[model samples]
Target: MRLYKIMIVDDEAEVRQAIARKIDWRAVGFEIVADAENGRDALEKAETLELDVVLTDIKMPFMDGLELGAELARRKPNLKLIVFSGFDEFEYAKEAIKLNVVEYVLKPVNAAELTAILDRVRGTLDAEIEQRRNIRQLTQAYQESLPLLREKFLLDLLRGPMDPQVLEAQAERFGLAVREGAYKVAAVCDIVHGGEGRPALSDELVPVSVRQMLSDALWDRCGSEIVLGVPSILVATAWERDPVESLMRLLGEVCTECKRILGVTLAVGIGRPCQSLAELCRSCAEARTALEYRAVVGLGKPIYIQDMERLDRTAPEWDGHREQQLLSVIKFGTREQIAAMVDKLLSDGEGEWSDQSRVLGILGTLLSILRRCRLGEEAMLGPRGSWIKLLAEDAPMEALRDWLLSVCLNMSGCMDQRRVSTAKRLVEEAERYIREHYPDSGLSVDRLCEHLHISQSYFSTIFKQETGRSYVQYLTDVRMEHAVELLRATDDKTYMVAEKVGYDEPNYFSYVFKKRFGVSP
Candidate 1:
């Protein structure tokens, strides 16, 4: 709706005036804002005026249009420039292109040709403005609705046992398209330990930005867009093309790049390929299952689902005794006791068992207990303690039990030196907080900021910089881990566990839990 301001620069006043008068500028939504008789004068005017397009003659006193154009470009990259030259020289045209001039017209320009050039430049400017606006809108929307969109995306991908068509349609709606073929899901895990005195990793792992880079990289390599389901990066490519190998290599490269460029550590787990979108849920499950092996496998390493042997049915079923023991160690045991128990479990070698599955199961059970305990505490502590309700949730006991065992098994292997001690310590501190006060409904960034005696922005930046995770993400991880515990150890309803974990809304809680574990809580 606004008029584009145009500027004309030429050595001769007649030439500049003649060209300006020839065009019906108003009809084309343009206004001739200024005229300069030389390049030096043109440069001065460009700096002073907010001009959209500059038409200049190549030859001028004091400053040649070429030099002036170059300087203008340096000062304002977004400024559109057009050059007119008496000499039809290829060198001048090439220089104009290098300076990113919008167009080059010869002296005594044909009216029709000049009009066509103007039309083309106008179209380009319009498109650029539109793209910028779209990007802004999308970015704003994403920022305001991040938590909700993230939960929904992960829920749809991990839970819902949905039909293949439905899944594909969902992907399409999100602007993610995958070809019909084998696909694998990858979970990127960043661990932050308290008392590490190191920078947080959150700034380095902005899901949207990371997704954009990954999508661009994958699209360039495979000619298809990468479907990003946060914490989970999904790539759909042909098995014959060796999508797994490609994915592993890509993740490895990405990790190395992040470390080199951003000073961050990342662990990636890749699930086996699923033939159809319906089976993608399983793939999601496998990727999360692999994350439990972080300690043993080492951080910043890529773990593949196929690398892990399938669970043997002949193994002894996980009993409540071990679950209770693990829970006790987590709840009240000393660090040494917990460490020793973890080491013993890792070395026990349950023989080709579903180690990943077991860890998720244990986490689920522990979270459930924590949730219930928090809920009861809330009742006793009154409204001030009611905050705990925000982090509690009800999950499927059977599925959670299975997931906990996998988590425990996986964690047992993680006690090695490869898992940075500082990172581990920070994670421990954060975990402790989640366990003790998850029921606090007011447990949020503002409260945490006040408690830490830091600005919210700085606290958020530092927390993410150190942990490689946002506060919400880390909290969700802890809560979901507890959800798995509840799902296994009790007959409590799913919604109840959801509430117990501090989730006021069961549906939203389930969505978040499922996204984390690749199965409905």
Candidate 2:
């Protein structure tokens, strides 16, 4: 049984003394810590003692019980208040209710009634203390899970797009401070036994060791979050001009040290530099593409996507790069994007036909894509090799252009149907989660994405397209609806209502309410 510190306040000293004498402070799990003649005096005394309860009279000179209770509520929101008075006035009772007074009793004090009130206060205090303990335990658990949460954030950064503001907030929450500079992404792939066509056998510790080494190497040069995964360690770095080259040098050293120290060889794929963290997903994708070129650049080195682009630019004939670009457009690009890319590939800058070799390369790429999409090539090209006959005829440019556009657009339509169904499911889940968790003040887009096991960028895109509002806007609307209902159905105060509707700061909640409804809460 813990002792709760309490104070007694009344304008008359005799009444205060009588009230103190009527109760067994210790027996009721309380201590009469202080006594005062008026609300002002009690408030002054309150500044010195950490009190759990205040028993004060309703009509006190200098300041009344209502004023003192309001001030105390602001200073110590959890403090319990009880008002007792000689006169029974409905106005006083109304004010007491507004002040969140736990009990309003009439004087002269009755030992039995006062003791019962104190017992109830004791029970309330006990519950509050237990709640505090639980929150402390939760806080400790959160600290313990910080590392895993931070890893998830890094993975999110690499896997999908995050708005700049949301990205900064999430980074700050995870203790990953965002610096003011450009960022670049790198994929440290081909671990000891985690490369393509290789089995991941008893090499889980290799990535952990590589992450530590990478951290140690980049700790002074730049800030890096190295995410350890099978087959690769994704590194996002804040670096400056000559970013790719600088990263290549740093990664080369990490690779050398890794091999020399751990008896393992690895390759690094570096992406192009991005101006902001939001663009990291693109950089990450490019980095993964760079990893595929390890066979050409040889393993145990840092391969850059820019270097591959330079090679593609210098190639005289149709190459793998062109084939990849066309296939990507058909599979993932929008209809407009697919059309523009095909037109660019077929036109020789002056709207004339490009050379036959380039047209042939694009045709072959489309054939491969059709096969991959499980569509019959003959259905697309009319009896397999007949596309070659069409290519060799006069005025073949228009025919080839129209045929290629139709095929790419049709593929895009098929892809979009599947994508739209997935997007609808994602949006539905998001709405359900928001509705269920609207009262949670910590609910955020990052948390929602984590719950859905998807990227923030993808989720945000689909959610806005489907709902015609951002996640924050939608959450705000939901909170406001519940808040309006609570206000209409209950006598809860504005602060209480705010807490129930997922706002930790009552002032901010009121501001939002006013902004949305044009009236203060």
Estimated TM-score for each candidate = 0.34, 0.35
lDDT of each structure?
0.57, 0.71
Predicted structure 2: lDDT: 0.71
TM-score of 2: 0.35
Give the per-residue Cα lDDT of candidate 2 at 143: 49
Which parts of model 2 are misplaced by more than 4 Å? 1-319, 328-363, 370-402, 413-428, 455-469, 490-500, 504-511
Q: What are the root-mean-square deviations of the candidates from the true structure over C-alphas?
A: 25.6, 23.0
Question: How accurate locally is residue 368 in candidate 2, as Cα lDDT from 0 to 100?
Answer: 66
Which prediction has the highest TM-score against the true structure? 2
Q: Which stretches of candidate 1 lie over 4 Å from their true place?
A: 1-154, 168-175, 183-185, 189-205, 223-240, 310-521
lDDT by residue (tens digit), candidate 2, 1-521: 66888899987878887887778889999998899877756876775476778988778766788889898865444468888876665356556556547887787779999999889988887764443334344345434533777787888888777878988888777766334565655554667543444321125445555666667667766667777655577888876553654566567666655554455778777777777777777777777766665544466767766544432322112225676677566656767888899889887889776866777777778776666445556665666556566776744667778877887787766655644666688899899999999999999876897787654434655688899987888999999999999999999999999999999878768867997999997
